[model samples]
Target: MRNSPLHGLRVVEIGTMLAAPFATHILSQLGAEVIKVEPPAGDPTRSLVRGGPSGTFIAYSHGKKSACIDLSTPGGRAALHKLLAQSHALVHNLAPKAARKLGVGREECAALNPELVYCHIRGYAAGPQQDDLASNPVAEAATGVMEGNRINGRPSRLGPSYHDQFAGAYAVIGMLAALLQAKTGAADRHVEVGLYETGLHVAARDLVGVQLKTQLLGRAEREPHGEFAMPGYGAYLTADERWLYLLMLTDGHWLKFCQALDLPQAADPGLARLKDRKKAREQVEELVGRAIGALPFDAAVARLKAAGVGCTEVLPLERVLEAPQAQSPGKLREVAFRGLQFQVPEFPRHPDADDAPATLPPAALGQHTREVLEQAGLSAAECAALLDSGAVRAVDPAGFAWAPVRATS
Candidate 1:
């Protein structure tokens, strides 16, 4: 957008995997120019078995320029230093020591640019396990997120990458706070976000639920029944075997539900109130299930809603893609890469740029290395030497040109 909040900001993202890259991609979506520095192997995500671009990679890597630089080499480190010197921010998710070893640690980066907003993401907090590599399920498991998500009495991890994305979003919030400080003429600052901590934060509600069940409900000896324990707050199967979720948490909703079903048992004094209904949970659930199961899916959903109970048919992933809500403007953005077109959710939105957000394709590996180096004032021969020495890699840049004048470093 012409007046995007992050316009003219420059970020150097020395990130691997999902978290850090996703944070930087958020910045890019908000109109920052994010230069994603990858190792020679190209972030390891490029090798996924996907038919085209890896979904995980594309989701987090979109709208950023990629520069392949082998940080193990002196030339590569020097180039990164130059970029950081000109960048407004630097973000990475490398292990603590690995970041320091590459000379991109918080202190090193601050020394390069005193006003830079630096963000570091790691697997855990600053403890003995701080330096261990962390990915999605690892942090999810370590933080007891999996344990809290019980399915049929067995602990299960979420299939989606929750910890990684949560950490990334947390890092983005930190970056934005630091950027605000810098804009006010503050010195460079560092923000650290850990996947383990994010996992804990994400599962905080469940943790609270567990405590309430044990302490308040006095169910310490019994594993508290889940949402389905509430008569009106559960799923029901229709005649066609499709499921619909019903949420009747309040007395008003419960009364409406009972009135809609016209259940003679609901009029009983013992079952009129929610507290009493809890005592007859099985009977209520059975009644609700039978009432719902006698109808088709649509009829079941309509009945529940007509009764003032919030309800929706459980949608599979494929059905969700076809839903009208998914087709709403600004919900998804169309983007193209290498002549292939697809849609991704438009996110990291701004109040001002709601209608004019950029939908640029992700950069090809090393697609902007030469362009960035040239903008950094490197001679063509110097750029050639770096590429030839295997210190850096780049595409021809064919028609791409980027400016280095608004250096963030």
Candidate 2:
């Protein structure tokens, strides 16, 4: 019953994929009344994978309502405009050309509601390469992330959905700033965020470093890209095939690590010194790897921890879900829906000690269609008519899948 940070704010979401929806998802978690406007076939993310809800969709769309509308239709567009007129903000990720065709572009929406903050998410900003197609991997490749991730001759992409998540965070920050500006009586503002731009921003340090050296940081670069810069900060495979990632940056921790591994000569040989260890990176890695390989995973981790070195077992997805850290007090919560238990991360606490409400499981497609329409002032008859006219549809308990229209020759 307590007021949340975003209490009383209303957001209209017209995004199908990750970035824009993710921004609105934060607003929703902070108590905004977010109404997600899905196409007749629904957001592509809803059907991106088989079985259960699209994990990405479920994660981003928790605590929001949904409505299926065929925006290309005149009646649907009118309904969307009405929704926009009542909303405080609009967030979308439609392609530039598609947004123009649907009449939901920033200029058009601002014309309808001068106070509405409109946020647009794109694959790239306006420039010579503005029109280029950029999915997450493509953006990563373009921004040098994928290339920099290669080490020891093994080139690999970053872990799941990094670009989408990063861009989403940036878009949310922009929208939040616009909201503050609106409260200050500033006119409605249009904000744009691009995945490629966010990716480049994330790699700013590496890019700048390479520029300074007059050489591009390519996949062929042998230098480590991440915390690997620290001589003792990296992953080591244990005798039991499990990995133990440890960080021993300070001199005290390095000494403790050598003592923990019972390698007295490790310190005497000057491997404990930062500069010397970095200079002999390969030799240090080999010695550490050999020591780790000699011990069972759990025992090695216990030894390192007992010696005051910060170390943890590298957890896989399933293990992460059941991690002790995740189950600790005030960490994660489990919500049940339709005989399924869903675990979601709790919101970050506000400095003033206020917190958002407990999360609701993601809606089952347009699960609250009738309720949402009624709340929006549509009569029951009108709601039925809209459904019958193919302008809207309710979530089917049986579920549905996306089938994008294909061009025929």
Candidate 3:
């Protein structure tokens, strides 16, 4: 196997849902041994969709180990402390107050492992609104993303869980930086990433533009802005009712686009300049709409490609998976769990190489309790006792298939 950038590093993740786990997912990809510590009931995301628990769980937790402990129990806290003491880092998304109640707060964990790079992902930073509990939608709503999405009039949520995922990415970057600092002799660092803050940053360009009132030359909106009124820059519905997104950024591409649609007048006299193009947006849009509506989806796509116009069918999720771009070597990976097959997208190539594995199936709740406890230097008897006493529990009493080293005889 190729060497991973995070090889030999150990991370214990106590975060449920997205933010912290997503950050650790990046670390796990980079070859870090990330042990996800979950409650006996497991991370709620494990049962997110209607499907049985396994699929959803496996999707988020691929390439990681699981350990289930009842943090409410003293024995459970002892076992967790043991794991924390031996870990290089801990990433958690628990609320500060909740974490303090659970005894895994930064102060508590850092005292156990001073060298640990501890990252706390929160929904909001300490502020007037610090006490507000925010989920993805709340964060989006607070950050103006929801408003941006509804710019056309009707308010709606963005398709994906952007706030959670972006916060996770931010947390990952912070974790890596903190790890580097620790290597260079810095003390353990406590990094906090707020999902609301991430949402705010994700809307940075728009926010900045609105704040600064910086519009594009001769236009009322900002540059790189989407053109709802322009014919070439927005989605066009085909005869089959599928949408096609056309992007003709340059004059050359615009000419080709006009040629492809057999509407040479689209780039003619009155439409020659960009200002004129904007002025005639409604007419241009109607013309383009009629042209696209006249052609079958594939035929239109072929015509655009042949004419050197950048185009792509607005694909459904299933179609996207089957697209040639998705099937390229090293682009996607197939993973199986209990005879169930699923696919996960591979990481983009980095100058150093892909940091993490292509796929890490999610874990069963408390699947690695016995194994993890044993790795933390608990004796078999002690592990069994803890389980029997309800200090820890494994979803599968048989424990996970992975090995947890036993202490030397």
Error of 2 at 95 (Å): 0.7
Candidate 2 per-residue C-alpha lDDT over 122-208 given as tens digits, one digit per residue, 9 for 90 to 100: 889788876666778888888887776775767567768788878878987898898888779887578888889999899898777
The number of clashing residue pairs in model 1 is: 7
User: What is the TM-score of candidate 3?
Assistant: 0.88
Q: Sort the candidates on TM-score, descending order.
A: 2, 3, 1
lDDT scores of the candidates, listed in order: 0.79, 0.79, 0.79
Candidate 3 lDDT tens digits, 1-409:
2477888888999978777878888788778889999887678876554434444356567888889888889999999999999888898988777888888988898899898888888889878776667888888888877765764677678867778888988988998889888778888588888888888888897787765654544444544333443446878999999899998566677778888878977548787666777777778778778999999999999999998888888878777889887887766668776556888776566534545454556666776778888888899999999999998987774433433346898
Model 2 regions lying over 4 Å from their true place = 150-156, 215-227, 350-354, 377-381, 400-409
lDDT of 1 by residue, 1-409 (tens): 6676788888988887788888887788788889989897777665563323477777778888888888999999988888888888888888888888989888888888887888888888787888788778887788766765788878877888868888989998988888787778877588999898888798787667678778987874333544545676878898999998888787677777777767676567787788888888888889888887888987766766777778887888767757787786666778776566777777834434453446668788899998887776778999899999999997644422322246578
For candidate 3, the lDDT comes to 0.79
TM-score of candidate 1 versus the correct structure, residues matched by position:
0.88
Q: In model 3, how large is the Cα lDDT of residue 99?
A: 87
Looking at model 1, the pairs that clash are 85-409, 86-407, 86-408, 86-409, 87-408, 87-409, 88-408
